[model samples]
Target: MLLLLLLQQLLLLLRLLLLMLLLLMLLLLLLLLLLQLLILLQQLLILLLLLLLPLLLILLLLVLQLLQLLQQLLLLLLLLSLLLLLMLLLLLLLLLLQLLLLQQLIILLLLLLMLLLLMLLLLLLLLQLLLLLLQLLILLLLLLLPLLLILLLLLLLLLLLLQLLLLLQQQLLPQLLVVLVLLLHCYCFYYYS
Candidate 1:
């Protein structure tokens, strides 16, 4: 009766040990799955960066083109202003030469009005340039938004991975210790018997 009871107890201990081993294996499998998920996330991040690279380059090119166009427009405006100033000086000379001629005065007035119109057109061009600059700023913001979102996602994943690792450590260490103690107890029991 004593031997039978001892044998039953030993069997129970063996079953407990097997259950602990199975639990450990399940935990390890879960860790593997988490690691795989982390790897997949990293790969996805790399792919996203790769996809964004071309778009970033295109945006940079567009911004460069816009800047170049703005510079050209500014040069044109400067040339136009210089031409208007030269025309004004020439008209003043003509006015002095034909002070008694009404036709000459009338033509000078028309030329002055045209210069004002040109100035207004320059202002409109400047406004258009401002609008283009605003559009470029908006495009830059749009581009940065996705990058920010991706960074946030990566940070979240890292935090989750850390938490998982900490939880695994907390849960696994004590369980491993228990398993080792049980194994030692079984070994001692067998030796003593």
Candidate 2:
């Protein structure tokens, strides 16, 4: 009984340790998620810097054309700036789409991780159940041991009884043979007389 109690306490401690480890893993995953978000933010800042480049170039071009007082070049510069603006807009749109896709991917990855955690928890639960089943089997064997011993004793007693019956049969058969000879002798004497 004391040993059983110790085993149960040990199992409890093990369960607590596993739970703590799981919690630590979850914390680490959360930290990784935060780091990824920081990286994504840094990438966004870099993209924003890239987005400003065309506007700055267009401004510099306009300032140069104004300083030179060139009318024909001014019109060309305006058209060039308009084209750059349109390209910038398309680039921005594509970047936005890419960012949306990345966010979705990140969300999917997080969901997958959560599913993996759940699976791990289920596996732990199954392991605990298997341990409990093993304990129950051990207890059942302990319970059955005395009953098995009793059954064996009963079998031995039955074998002894069978032996005794065989001995009785052996003795009775000889006695019956002797009585038959005596009866035969009596019959012969009466016939002779």
Candidate 3:
């Protein structure tokens, strides 16, 4: 009887060991599944970043281009303002000359009217440029090409007007040569700048 009871107890212990081993194997499998899930998540995150990186770079480049355009526009504004001031000075000088020269009153009056028209045109051009710049800020890449063409055309018109003024000045008086030359220099500087 004693030997039989000892054999039964050993059998129970072996069965318990088997149950524990099965539990351990199940736990290991759970741990492996968790590790695989973590690895997959990490890979997905890397892929997302890779996909977004180029778009982010493109946005950054666009912002930099906008900044450069704004700077150029500001410079153009400054030049236009300077030109306006110079025109005002020339108008004042012409007025003084008109007062002193009674014999050439008719010619001086015509020149004065032309200069006034030119000043008004310049004012209109400045306003148009400002409007175009505002549009550029809003429209960005879509309007960029057309804005450039418009600016070029405006500059050409300005050059033509300047040439006309120079011709008039040459016909009117040699004394105005110095002022017209200065004006030409300013226009050249603005063009190069």
lDDT by candidate, in order shown: 0.70, 0.59, 0.64
Give lDDT tens digits, candidate 1, residues 1-31: 9999999999978867766675676567567
TM-score of each: 0.52, 0.32, 0.55
Tens digits of lDDT, candidate 2, 76-155: 45655665675566556557757777666655565566567556655765665575566556555655654565576567
Pairwise lDDT winner, candidates 1 and 2 = 1
**Model 2, residue 113: C-alpha shift (Å):** 94
Span of ten consecutive residues with least summed lDDT in model 2: 65-74
TM-score of 3: 0.55
Ranking, lDDT, top scorer first: 1, 3, 2
Q: Encode model 3's per-residue lDDT on 86-145: one tens digit a residue.
A: 778767777777777755866567677767867886887778688767757665764454
Candidate achieving the largest TM-score: 3
Stretches of model 3 off by over 4 angstroms after superposition: 98-193
Inter-residue clash pairs, candidate 2: none
The TM-score measured for candidate 2 stands at 0.32
Q: lDDT winner among the candidates?
A: 1
In model 3, which range of ten residues has the least summed lDDT? 171-180
